[model samples]
Target: MRLQVKKWNLSNHSDYEKQCGQYCYKIVKTLLNFLKFLKNENDNFNSIIEGKDRQIAELQAKLTSLYSNEHKPNEFDSLRKLITESNTAVINELRSQFLDFHNNGEIKPPYDSLKRCQNESTEYNTKVNESKGGETYIESPYPNSCVPFGNSSKQYKINVAGAGSFHVLCDAHTAGPGWITILRRADGKVDFDRDWNAYRNGFGSLNGDFFIGLEKLHYITKSQPYELYVHLKQLNGQTIHARYGEFAISNEKEKYNLIKLDLYSGTAGDYLKTSKHTGFSTKNKVNIQYAKKFNGGWWFNDYTKSNLNGKYVADNNLVGMFWGDLKILNLVKMLIRPKV
Candidate 1:
């Protein structure tokens, strides 16, 4: 038996072209208007361009299939070649823009965010990788290095849009005379006297002298022992809580003591915890309270007992983290924000 293939027909589509074109025309017009609207943005430039690239690629794909197959009109041959070439060119252009601006080819958006998030003051050395441009590869400047957390506490607002794993590095050996705080404000504006809630962490020797932790700012002082001072902006804020927090750590340590802060989904909710390789380990669950015995002590991982990794120390002079989930909105900037 002989089998024959049937040639497809665009004429059959004549019935739908007018209707489809009318609908698509409206969508295309809307998209163009939206693109223009996005042009006003200087902050999310990379994201905007990325979105444009995706739309271009998708539209090209659809058109290429139409022209190459069933709908191969007499006018389509040159157009098909142009669309295929445009796909390559457009993609190359997008990639080229990234390399020019970011010096990295594998970049994703929130464009300028692809660059280092540094304070205008060279003094605050939040050393970001000039090429990669993010908080992921931050480096503290010197021994006992300490800087104000999340920009200035009084002037700028550090906002977060999502929640994820993060870290804190410092002289855990010396602990430090430093602290970092993540606050939840009314309008991303932190009012020290009135802001609702926050998460704080630190390391150092002077901790007893100037540590303002989970406690509310009003109730906290450099020397206060009030742990419940957390000013709650909202409970669910953790779920979408834009990643914003205060941080302080001593650069005085001899080793980098990589403190991995893990916040992810768990049995109860989004839990924030930490881990270290040696010395003392961060408690599996955050210790929400400060008592006479475990006051400043980090939560000891129950499984590992007191030692970090496997090494044990008798010094009861450390503290750890907690666990839970929450939601936040419209986080503009923070060292530990959403998943890029």
Candidate 2:
């Protein structure tokens, strides 16, 4: 009787062991399934974040276009502010979530991708803000500086017959009351080492350092004869100018050729008048070797004597904003007006 009781207890113990093993297997399988679900969720989250980032990038591009216009509507400020705030909030929220996931020891996050997105957003904002020349105001309907829109502001907008409308810094108190500043380089805040398209379309701030654009220049001069004023400053605070009685340029098909530049009279030497160059050359177009050799854009023939768009400071070659033998100038400005 004792042997039988021992055998029965052993059998029951074996059955109990089997049942425990099965339960443990089920628990492990359930845990594994849960982990897989969590991993999938993490991947989905990352995909969603990436999608949002793409959307934000698209919006940023559009924003850049809106702000690139020198002139803006009255509602632009408010609209831009709202969009910026909203984007900021979204970025902040995404950052917070990313940090939370990282801390929780969940699936490994794409930290580098998130960092790249943040940096891009910041850079875009900075560029947009800088490109927005200045405050918005009602643009005058004058054809050019010749038609005076009296006392509006230091910088004002005018419409050219073929070039549409754009801003210009009026020199009401400088050499003349009606002079319109086309190019000004008070500092190196703006980069002038650019390609043909960039030089043609123009860049920089009108109220600060800027270029009035080549296409616009062509139309403005084409509509009527205009005089040129080349104002320059040395590092030692001395200022000089080169005034031309007549100046004009050809259209795009002609590579914006320097059609006429004559009757020069100013303290600064007539370097441009002496040069035999006829067309504009940028860093990537026309006379590529000379443009690259000088490290900037200008009218280049066999050689170049003046490269106003060169490096801000003189390099080893002493190639910079120079005229004649004067190199590495501190400041320079070019103004134009109807030859009245």
Candidate 3:
């Protein structure tokens, strides 16, 4: 009986050993898998860190190059400086060079030369050298008015003929697109009651209220025949527009005279037609009797017809942005497009 009992105990002990071995093998396999996962995660983390380090090194190199004494300014930088300086002699000299290039057939034309230069300048200023994946290129400046953008309502940089490069808000969705907003008054953040210089050179933000400037207006209008569209919004959200088939203004020497306002048609009355042949007037440069009294800039007539640049008020006062007897406007926009 004692021998049989011993045999039974020995068999049970052997089975217990086999079970322990199997359990230990499973624990080892699980540990190996866990270690492999940790290794993979570490490799991935290292790769990401290396990529970030490369980006950082590239950025540091660019920064060093930008601030280096050996860095040279490109043609675009030179032109931007000249335009910003506003030196008449330098500008004339540049124009003369462009004309010479035109005459020599090296460039297409004077306008094209300026436009090319401005486009290159814009590209140069916008280009950022970085990693292949990080590199980005902005679209070149529009060669002419709003025509280049083509039915896309957004602010685009336009190189005006003989007027240099600047941004303009193109009204594409409203009234069949391709209209350049020269003046807009909304929120009254900009002070339109400015001086002759301010009015001539322009002021305010394109995103808010802004005037595209008289000199720019003269160049743009004189370049091609344009139809003017004056948009007005009432306090009640009603809107009206006055479109003129012919609209233009003279140069600064002529005091930016409103030369033409023919073929007017719109919901608004033809009050501006009376101001035809009149020059523009600000508070300081009052060409008309009511120029100072109106306290804003416009081609004012002998009487108070319309003052879109007048004080922004919430009432139906004559002093606000009113067209003839129209009530004080909530918003006003003056845009133009090349005659179709």
What is the C-alpha lDDT profile of model 1 across 274-322, one tens digit per residue? 3232222222223222211232232233322221111111222332112
lDDT of 2: 0.72
Off by over 4 Å in 3: 1-141
lDDT, candidates in the order shown? 0.29, 0.72, 0.72
Clashing pairs in 2: none
Report the lDDT tens digits of candidate 3 across residue range 282-306. Answer: 8788564465677678887676488
Candidate 2: lDDT of 156? 77
lDDT of 2 by residue, 140-231 (tens): 35645633844433877777655667777787554666777778888788888888998898888976777777888888888677889998
Q: Which candidate comes out best when scored by TM-score?
A: 3
Worst 10 residues of 2 by lDDT: 70-79
Judging by lDDT, tell me the better candidate of 1 and 2.
2
